[model samples]
Target: MIQAFVEGGWAMWPLLVFGMVTIGAAGRFAHRPQLAQLRFIGAMSLLTFVTTFHATWLAISAVLSYLSKLEDVASDQLVKILFTGLMESTRAGGLGGLLLIVTLLLVAIGTLRLTPKQG
Candidate 1:
């Protein structure tokens, strides 16, 4: 797990930061459901999703660039290398996505609290 994170390069660190902030905001919103918290959660959710894909694509691009630099590599070996890098790169996005899902669930719960009670 740690190795996969390390393989994600510098992008993982920022994604981690964003994910943590989003989770914190979402948790707060779940507890209180304030207008300001709602707005912040919405924005943070979007930011987290964008950062997730950005990190994923960045890692994929790096893999492709590295593959291009190789000369006369075996076909099977190349495939292995490509997949390994891709799998490693996806770790950041996967973690971000998991965080986003959790935060969204919290946001949904918070929204439920916003609905007026009826007899």
Candidate 2:
């Protein structure tokens, strides 16, 4: 988990904070359902989605920049480098996706709890 965060670079920090706040709010909503908390969770999820892609793009750009500087690099080595960079880049997206899923589940539970028992 810590390794992933380090490989994910700066983008992961904001996402970490967003995820924590969102999960906390969602959990709170579940305990005491509130419209405001639901809205906050929704907004945080959206932000998380955007940041995930943004981090990926940054990583890709870095990889491209690094590749551009190379001269006469072997195909096998180039492929290895590309693969490694792409894999590292995906860490941010993976974390964001996990956070989104958890937040959504919490929101759903909160919604279910918020609604009165239909008779």
Using Cα atoms with residue i matched to residue i, what is each candidate's TM-score against the true structure? 0.88, 0.90
Which predicted model would earn the best lDDT? 1
What lDDT would each prediction earn against the true structure? 0.87, 0.84
lDDT of 1 by residue, 1-119 (tens): 78878988889988989989999998987887766677778788888889989999999999999999999999999999999999988987778988899999998888777655410
Q: Write the per-residue lDDT of candidate 2 for residues 64-83, one digit (tens) a residue.
A: 88988998999999999999
Clashes of each: 0, 0
TM-score of 2: 0.90
Clashing pairs in 2: none
Worst 10 residues of 1 by lDDT: 110-119
What TM-score does structure 1 among the candidates reach?
Answer: 0.88
